[model samples]
Target: MLLGTPAAPADAAESSLFRGTRQFPETALWNDSADPAELVRSIGFGAVGATCNPVIAYTAISKHLDEWAPRIARIAAENPTWGESQIGWRAVEELSIQAAKLLEPAFQASGGRNGRLSVQTDPRLHRDADALVEQAVRFSLLAENIIVKIPATAVGIRAIEEATYRGVSINVTVSFTVPQAVQAAEAIERGLDRRAADGLPEREFGSVVTIMGGRLDDWLKQVASTQRLLIEPGYLDWAGVAALKRAYAIFQERGYRARVLSAAFRNGLQWSELLGGDLVVSPPFDWQLRINENELPVVRRIDVPVDERIIAELSKISDFCRAYEPDGMTVEEFDDFGATRATLRQFLDADAQLDALVRDILIPAP
Candidate 1:
C-alpha cells in the first residue's frame, strides 16, 4: 500500500451487465475519466481502472468547480512563485491522486496489474525525450497504481523505453496505427530487459498501450470527404474496429507483455467489437452509462475479423494502409501521421485551456 493514500473501499457489487461481461478475465472495463464522482459510479459498474489527459482534467475540474475552485485558489496562494501551467498541473496531480485512491481495492486485489489510473505527461514535452522521462517518473510516484501516459511519436518512443527502464509503468498514447503500437511495445520490452539485466524487480508494472481507434475513424472520414471518394455506406465506421482487431491479433501472435487498450470512443462498435481479447476498452463515463442503458449483451467478438471487402476498400486509402499494416510506418514517420498531428494539437490546446483556467483563478478579468 502507498503511504499517505487512503485504503480503498470494499468492492461494490458489479452491475448485471458488467458482471456478465467479466466472463472473460482477459477483457476488462476501465473508466476514461478522472472525476472521482464518475469513477465512484463506474466502480459500481465494474470499472477496474481509469485514464486522464489534459482535456479530462480540465473537464473534471470545470464540472466540480465548486469543490476545485477553492482548491485552485489555495494552490495558487501556496505556490505563489509558480506559473499557471505549474499550478494547473499541481491541480491535475491532486485530481489524479484522489482518483487513484479509489482504485486501490482493485489494485491490491489484482496485485497491481488491474487497478490503475493513467495520468498523461505534459503534451508540450512530446519532442523532448528527457523532459518526458522526467515527468513520467514524477507522475509514477504520485501513487502506487499510477500509470504514466506518453505519446508514441519519434522522441516519445525513446522516452517510453527510458521511463520504463526507470520503473514507471507507461501507457503509450497518441498512437493510432499498428506500427506505433508495435514500436512502443518493443521499446517497453527493451526497457524491461534493461531492468532485468540490472537486477531490478519488474513486479507491479502493469503497462498498457492505447490505440485511439475513434480518432482514426474521424480522420478517415475527413480524408474521404476532402478527396471526394464515393465510399460505400457504413464502411467508414469499421476503420478503427479493423485496426484494433489487427493490432490485437499481432499482440497475441507476438505475446507482447503490454496489453492493447482501445480508446477514443466514437461509436458502439468501439465497445462491442473489441470484447473478449486480453485488452482494455476504455470508454468515457457517459459512454459506459449509455452502453448500460442500451443493455448490449457482453459478447466475445475480439477475434471476429472484419469483412474482407471492407478491408480491401479501406486499404485503398494510403493513410489507412499506414495504420493497418505493421510495417507501413517507421518510427521516424510517427510524428507526421495525420492522426498523431491532430491528437497532439488537441492535447496541447487542452494544456493551454488548463493554464487559462488557473489564470482565471489567479488573475481575474476586470
Candidate 2:
C-alpha cells in the first residue's frame, strides 16, 4: 500500500497566510544577517535587502575563512606594507560585495528602491567626521547598491551630510530618539540639496534612520530593576515602539524622504504593533520566522498610549525622559544621552573584536 504524503507544517501555512495578506504593503522586509546563505534564505522569504556591521562581518568571516582566505591572502600580498586593520577592512568590504551581488536581483526589480546592502564604517572613526567621510566613500565604491552605515553621533551626522553630498546613500544606525531621527533626515536633505544645486540627480539616492527597538526596552527594564520600581508587565516593552511611532509621525510631518527602519526587535509583539507604515522592519531571521508563524490581529496597536504614570516614573530618570520625548533632541543633548553613548561603546567593542580577528589571521603561532 502507498503511504499518503505529509501535510505542510503549521508554521509554513501560517507564513503563507501572512504573506498573502500583504498587510504591510509599504514596509519592506530586510534580513539582518551577514552570512550569504542566510541572506539567500531571507530573499526566498521575501526579504529585499540585508544589513551588516563589524559584528556580523566578524562572525561571517570567522565561519568561512577558507572561502575568504584566497582573497585575504591576495590582499595581504598586494599591499605588503598594509597593517592588520587595513586587511580586516578589505575582508569586510569583499564580503559585503558578495552579499550585495546576491541581493542584486531584488535591487534591480525594485529599480533601486530595495535590495540594498549596508556596510558600516569603522566605529573607531565615528568621532572623526573627516575620517568617517573618507571611509564611507571608500565603502560605497564597493557596489552601487551599497549603503554606507554611519553612526548617529554628532561627527557621524557631519560625515553623513558629506557622504550624501558626494552622492552616496546612507543608513544612519544607532538612532535612539525622535530628535536624532529628525536631525539625521535634515542632514541628508541638506546634502541632497547641495547635490541638486551642483546639477546632480537627488532622487536616485536613499537613506534610512535605523531606530533600535528592543534595546530601548532592555535599557528601561534594567533601570526599573535597579530602582525597585514595580512597573506593569508590558508597559516598559512598549517604550521603543512608542518612540518609533512618534519618530515616524515626525518624518511624515516634515515630509522627509529618509525611511524609518525598526530594528533589534525582541519579540513578535513589537513587529505586530509597528506594522503597516512606510517603515522597513528588519529583525533577525528567527524573529522573522516567529512573526510569520503567528497570525497578526486585524488592527495594529500603533496609537495605544502607555500609562502617563509609567512615563512620569521613567521621566525621573534623565535618559529615559530624553528618549521618550516626541520632539527631537539638540546635538548637544544627543552627546549626553545614555543610549547614544551605550550604542557607541557597543560599536567600538564590535570593531575591536574584528581587529583582533584580523591580527590572529595575520600573525601565526610561534
- For this target, which candidate reaches the highest lDDT against the unseen true structure? 1
Candidate 1 stretches greater than 4 Å from native: 1-17
What's the TM for model 2?
0.89
**Residue-level lDDT tens digits of model 2 in 1-366:** 001112543224435224523556567778887689777766666688889877778888888878876777788889999887888888888889989999888788877778899999888887799998998888888898999888888888888899999878899987777778888898999999899899987465657888887877777788778888777667777777777887888887888888888887786656766666777778787676656556545344455555577666566555566776755467667766666777778877877877777666677557
**Per-model TM values vs. the true structure:** 0.95, 0.89
* Candidate 1 TM-score, true structure as reference: 0.95
lDDT, each prediction: 0.88, 0.76
Candidate 1: minimum summed lDDT over ten consecutive residues — where?
1-10
After TM-score superposition, the amount by which residue 90's alpha carbon in candidate 2 deviates from its true location, in angstroms, is 0.7
Candidate 2 Cα misplacement greater than 4 A, ranges:
1-21, 294-316
State residue 285's C-alpha deviation in candidate 1, in Å: 0.6
